[model samples]
Target chain A: MKKNLMAVLVGVLLTLLSLSLIEVYYRAFVPPKAEVFAFVPSTPVEVPEARLSAELISQIQGDPIMKWRSLGSAYEGEYNAKVVDVSKQGPLGCCVLQGFFAPPGKVHSRAYTKHRDLLYDVHFTFDQRSRRITPEVSHARNALLAFGDSYTLGEGVNDEESFPYVLGTYRASTQVYNLGLMGGSANQTLYEVTKLPEKRLPDLPDQEVTAIYTFMVDHLERLICRSLCLTAQGMWRLNQPFYSLKNGRPYFEGAFSDRKVLNSFYTWFHQSAIVQGTGMVLPPQFTQEHFDFFATMMVEIRDVLKTKYPKLKFYVVMYPGSSDPYGSDLTAACKKRGLNVLNYASVDITGLAQKRERIAGEGHPSPIAHMILARLLNRDLPQ
Target chain B: MLLQEFWDFMRERKKYWMMPIIISLLALGFLILFSQTAVLPFVYTLF
Candidate 1:
């Protein structure tokens, strides 16, 4: 009986080992189909090379996102033209390109790039020397501060195609500073805003920044939680107490280690899953905290901006997601704070829904969503 | 006498049960890593 049992155990172990080997083999040897939702090139189409010129090269470099390409090779293609070294935007360095294919006469389909098989569509357009905000967007106004993650930063989309750029196009007079960094959480947004110089306020015309719009959605919860863990670990790494809260809540106060961990984890997770899929899941109850942090951050931003330009308008543009419930949470939060919240969920973004397959998989909004959002903001802005 | 023999038999066989658990955990870890880094990237390229 003892001998029989030993034989069975050995057999089971061999079987498991065999299975692991098979899995690795399959993954390494077999090239699976390209993920439909991620950015994989379709059939290579052709376009005229002459369409790209020194003038166009100069124009592309002017946008903050596209400017990094100035240091590397820019090649034209028959279908999708490629621009290398767009910048170190994410996990792997990003590449920018423009594809000339569009739905029958809709002009060129704006070209963009993706890293780790993620697709970002670039649709923003700029004139020669990309530095000058298009004449249409150079209006005099209180500063426009846009804050959010990849979506707000226009990941998978072109610099011109990002909603912020689109929105800027509508309001030609205002200086729209694109502070939307990818993988940013609400806390990071607050941290960044806190660091801005106070002396820059007096230069504005209205003596008040018109609006500070911070884009937010459910993903903020997971990012915040990861940020907290990273903060704790960093303190431990530095031989310091991570931190203890007054109310017995785990909060990181002031320690540089705490901040470093938060920043690192924020970057790590942002690249891992938060930016890859529909974002990390949060329990239903924690949804309120998500909205609250966003609100609190907005208030803090308002106070800081007000100190410099005492009469600035603060707006929170609730970002849309596949699972977002039509901005109900944002409306409630804004109502409580007496703030103006843009109801982008009400806008007709049906075109984006139709092209959803070309965009991010199952539920991510596509470039059409950005366009629809831009149109909504354009309509809402004081004409 | 038969009951006494059975108890001794059970005691001898006890170590074998742990073998399956260890094998299963190793399998699970390998599977997770393979799925995340290898399988997913290959699949991403196809679509």
Candidate 2:
């Protein structure tokens, strides 16, 4: 009987061991798709396609070159023929720029950058020209400065379709400068504003730069702690040629320490399939510090910009993420500091769809959400 | 006589029963830690 019991125990143990191995293998190999992360590019290339019709290619080639705004694609042909770096196209293949071709009326443009890959697509005429916000008009009308992460820079959206661009289009008289950069947190936002040139300050009509919009999501809260995770040894080999350790850890030597890169890499890794699939939830303990830092930064930015452009209006556009319970708390805190708070809950986003077919998924506010914000800002700005 | 002998054998092995109790306590500690640190915050945010 004892021998039989021992056999049963061994069988159970073997089954459990096999199950654990399978779970680990599945996570490592066939992990679920990352929902919110964008692709990072490995190299940069520019390609011109002659395969398109002579008329279309001519239009593209002839269009006066606009200042290059980082890495993005443009479309020219009927069916919206997309022009992108041939090498930067994703594993699923590059978009056929031809499908989006239509006479420009109210074109919807979206831009996204992942790793080193950048995608910009223009969707045609979902609204009228009056509904569109042009930068020229915005400059003519109000003193506008946009602050945020990559989304404010129109990541996964087109330069013209970016919120700043849209705001510019909406208010032809407003002067808008997009001080947004990818991977920027609230502290970085404050730093960027303080670093802006004085020459740029005089272009605004109001000595009080009437609007300062800061975009934020929960991910910003993770930056400091993650930075602490980088090790001294890891810092040494950040930018050198990539090498794998015996345990299969990949290392690259770069200007930044290994710990910095490792922190970002691990953060990105955890933020990818497993954590995102479960809905990008962060620990609550971080909420107070996150809100406090963000609020402090906003106040500092407001005071600094106010020193130069004293009449500056300040607002925070809460990036869409359901992960922070302190969301309401943050809004209330912002109110205490005399800043306008645009929480997702306050907006009429009911009309906005959540899928790719209608709106960008994850925490990204849909185009409709953008419209709501634009309208609110237009109405709220002190005349 | 056989029943009395079996009772005597059971009494000899009482110390072995403490092993399962120790494991249960360890598992309860883990459960409490996970609940407070990760699970509660997630639930609070969702609604």
Candidate 3:
């Protein structure tokens, strides 16, 4: 027994020695990089690249649940476009109440960098009544409602370059609402279409419209609040609405205000790769239910949207390509629930990496790609 | 000189416990050096 204990102790010592060496190697060779921590942003910091002013960036630092009161925290006006100030805003609610993330009549203008490190401007405008990003057209014979995360929101592109806006250009009579929330998941997109106020959802079927939910694999992490995608200076975001699966049915669990523990853990866990690869991650509250919940929410959104536009055709468009393990499952789920699904993996977004059509610093769909999707949608959307 | 003497003493006494201690100290020294470079971010990917 004595010999055995010594042997075991020696073995442990060896393992410790190995770890120590590895840690040393990491320390000796690795260069420090600007890393994002998984904590909810507190303390305003200057993001020189962002369009907002430095003073505004410093003001919105704090626990997100308490800080985010309204949609536009900072406000500025330019004849070029209506800009909503978000320097004071932080992570938003945990669950969707109005079936949307922002208030009505809001426009978000941001500056981003593309592949060559060249700068570009992007804008998102929400309609006055529906609160969705309607096309710039004044009068349209019909409308298209689109939703997803940043890519759908035209992350590195202008408002006119978003897929919804380009789709409106394809058919002058159709007004498209870009309901793509900045950091949304597929389930969150579904919630935005289904959870809005009664008056917000138009039940009358006077207009011919199409509702498309655009998604990418990256949204999976956002779906479960497993990661934080940097939005702006001092604007680390992940605190959107979350859902709970009870008795196999998905229900809203509330916003960041309601999920302090989960939010806090994610806020911390996302800080470093050391934290992530070391199993310092939080256990997800539910098994991968985004597919199920997404399907359910899409069905509900379709039903409610159908009440407004009789000619509405519901579609789930996977944008910037779909490479997630859940992509197929999401497609299957959407199809099983009677929603049309389109996989846009064929677009040669080589420009994204080459910085041709996409911005050099950010790898989101460029205006060229948005136009490509618009043309594709025009060809494929059910007439 | 003390570290060399300590190493000699550990070898003689078979003080395996000191291995972890020494390695950890060396590791800390490495971290101090490596943090100044760009390769540090990739270290965490090793799991």
Candidate number with greatest DockQ = 1
Compose the digit string of candidate 1's lDDT tens values, residues B1-47.
76456446545765444455555655545533332110011111111
The digit string of per-residue lDDT tens for model 1 on A1-383 reads 77768866775877667656755665556443221222211221111123334453333333343332221211111122223232223121111111011111111122233332223323433222221122243446545666555456554455565677767776766666555543344544444445434311224645435654645443343234333223221111221222223342333353334466456755564333312232221121345655665555566667766776666777766553321342566556655777777644433233223333124321223445555556555555553
CAPRI-style class, candidate 1: incorrect
Each model's lDDT: 0.42, 0.41, 0.50
Residue A329 in model 1: lDDT: 68
Q: How high is the DockQ of candidate 1?
A: 0.07
Worst 10 residues of 3 chain A by lDDT: A73-82
lDDT of 2 by residue, A1-383 (tens): 56545544565566556545655665677644222222211121111122224563333233232222222122111121223222243211211211111222443443333332324454322122111223554225456777664455443444455566656655655666655444344544444455443422344545446655555433333223332122221121122122222232212222223345555765554434333223322232455555655566667667777777766777776543322334466776677778777654322223222222112222233343344344445544554
Off by over 4 Å in 1: A1-143, A198-208, A226-287, A321-323, A346-353, A357-365, B1-47
- Model 1 chain A weakest 10-residue run by lDDT: A93-102
RMSD of candidate 3 to the truth, in angstroms, is: 14.3
Candidate 2 structure lDDT:
0.41
Summarize candidate 3's per-residue lDDT along A41-85 as a digit string, tens digits.
122111111433344223222213122122121111111211235
